[model samples]
Target: MHLTLALASAALIATINANPSYYVKPIEDENDYARVLELSLLFYEAQRSGKLPQNNRIPWRGDSALDDRGLNGEDLSGGYYDAGDFVKFGFTMASATTLLAWGAISWPEAYIAAGQLDELRKAIKWATDYFIKCHVSEYVFYGQVGEFFLDHTFWGRPEELNTTRPAYKIDPEHPGSDLAGETAAALAATSIVFRNHDPEYSDKCLKHAKELYKFANRYRGLYNEAIPGAALYYESTDYGDELAWAALWLFKATNNTMYFEEAEHHYQHFHLKERPNEFFYNKKVAGVQMLLAQITGQLEYQKAARAFCDFSVRQQKRTPKGLLYIDKFGTLCHAANVAFVCLQAADSHGIGDPQEYRQFAEQQIHYMLGGSGRSYVIGWGRNPPKQPHHVASSCPDRPAPCGWSELDKNAPNPQILYGALVSGPDEADKFHDRREDYVYTEVTVEYNGGFTSALAGLLQLRVKSIT
Candidate 1:
């Protein structure tokens, strides 16, 4: 650690140790959740893969992804970019947007209390609108916006990058069930968010969701096969889990028995009864089980949910401080995702005793919020991430030179991403807040969704306590 950052960390640690909640208070936690929603939208604004909308509030970014894939003269514009890169991976965007909408649906009160309900709605609508655009036909969905080789070469704002951003899609013969199913899930979930607010829009979302689900079912293949270029990035080995996930959400949104039957069939066919241990975007079994438990109140679903939670907790690897470190690359992401599931299960009424699971969730979440001796959220709590591995954040305010040398310096990010959660510590609970180390300091919408969802659940618990 550099001497300056090291001293700053030491001072921040002393302050936090003196007061356990100094860096993690209820009011501040609510503020953090709201800020996360804001920053998630800002990340989208900074990396929008198409023409800038007139209503864009994020001033630092503008239209950039023009010449996006001359494939069939399709308009492949207006989706959130993937990570720090300008590519718009529809699969990942759909999944992240679905989870973000899930946070809104499950905890509307938290968003309202935090004064972020409108922003959350806007973010969900932005991604879902892009999904609508991606679905040009009944059986076709464009899956990607930029070529990896071309986009990876540039490390500047999305608006500044100008290159061949190829668009990829899947058709009836060339199937992409996983991507399509996840998009369907995102639309279905967002439909619920707007059902009361905008009935016409809700119907539009559900209509597209149903069509996408049909496409996913009619052509049962992974997306990478159709778009081979995506193999290196958003590849999927199986599509059954996504199918089941979409079906369940569709059933929930429309309250249709046929959708429920389809979900049940897919659930049984995929044997989700045996939940997977990982909590990343690729795997949906654990989250599906939690949702199923809540919807059906079935003992089997509850059993699976508990089994999955227990399996995650029992992983042999852990930081000496017991942070449930899953992998070095996305340590906090995995833990935060698991924490969300745990808290979701704990909130489900008539389920098994949720106290234990709640406690487990709290421990993992607290670790991310400075319980591990430093905070991982950018511009929050104590000793937060000063240097995030984000291109826009690395560059000076705008119209300034942003080079590799700028990222190498031991300085705070140029932008104050209040609620952006950085990739966290290693298995030993050690973290380096450096911009060059993307693994440790990178911020992504998906990562923020996971942590923000968990924090929303936590704040929901606090509201329950006070009332």
Candidate 2:
């Protein structure tokens, strides 16, 4: 058995060495966490919707998607665009905001150390403000701003797109529990971030959050069926997990027993199991379990969280290069999200194996930072991607015509998308740097949020070790 194990290990090493990549050195950078955190803010700046302010960090981008007014004349103006497209998906936007806000709540010092707390705060406010606007009435909530087909037709700057973008909403008749729940979670989490800094705003946020949660619970139905437009994208399958996720955040923010009871009910209703290998916009089981374990110090929650992490580390399929594999398309995202869970578990006060979980999380993050022999982040390590599938970044500065030729072949992106993390390498750990390959080279706001959370956790662990 020992000899067989040795042979297998040697073969894996040989396979990893055979893979071709530009990065050929061990990862060693004390400033990586700071660098990534800075870049994440830049990504948010690029994805800004509505009137681009004068103080915007991304100079190349101007006012964009300003024409997005809701069907009921509600102002659906501000929020980050979803993925590489100029669309505002409320579910995804809320999920991203919740994760980003959680990172801020978990490790404010990391942002302070990196000198980006103000930027992070502004970014969080941008989304929460949009959420507040979207929740127009007791039941009515705007969930989407632009049509996928119409939005996908244009490939240039979001500011230049002058099409008639339609808006969609959810209410009692058109229920969207998942969307409402997630929006509540985002708002609840945001309230915590502003609890001390801005008491009035925090109370307002929490007030809206509670109302939205009530709406979600009262009208329990999927958004896709009611709205139909969400079917193509941002479609929600189950609303149970989202209910629990929102409830948990509300409980965290307010310490309300009612919210805790709701959270516990939904968590058990779903019969939380070992986390699946993939973490996507629609899935929140693993995240809920992990948070529950950390916050409540429950034995069941800890056991499930451990089982999920163990599945990711030991049972999940992996690339020869050591990345936990789910799909070749955005493989790094799954790893990044799970890395965050591991990192948080590592610091679970005393519920988890801090050393072991930290090691696992670090390995996954190192792979993203070039331990896989190439950097997946657009502007970080040696020979990072120069042609991410981003419309604004791919266009030349000011004068040149931004067309298919430029996107397909003419030149590398005229602007360096500083900290944008690309989708990443294939299942075999092979990468192609080009604009057309959206799966391997696209950047998203939420994607950056995941990386930011993971990096902040890493920085926190490092600081804890020294202190």
Relative to the true structure, how large is the alpha-carbon lDDT of every model? Answer: 0.76, 0.79
Q: How does residue 33 of candidate 2 score in lDDT?
A: 66
Task: List where candidate 1 sits over 4 angstroms from the true fold.
Answer: 1-47, 51-57, 66-70, 314-316
Give the range where candidate 1 is weakest over 10 consecutive residues by summed lDDT: 19-28
Say which candidate scores most in TM-score: 2
Candidate 2: list runs displaced more than 4 Å. 1-31
lDDT of 2 by residue, 87-191 (tens): 788888888888888888988877766666777889999999898988899888998888888877777777788667898899898899999999899999999
What is residue 245's positional error in candidate 2, in angstroms? 0.5
Q: Write the per-residue lDDT of candidate 1 for residues 292-348, one digit (tens) a residue.
A: 898999898888888877776665367998887777767888888888888888888
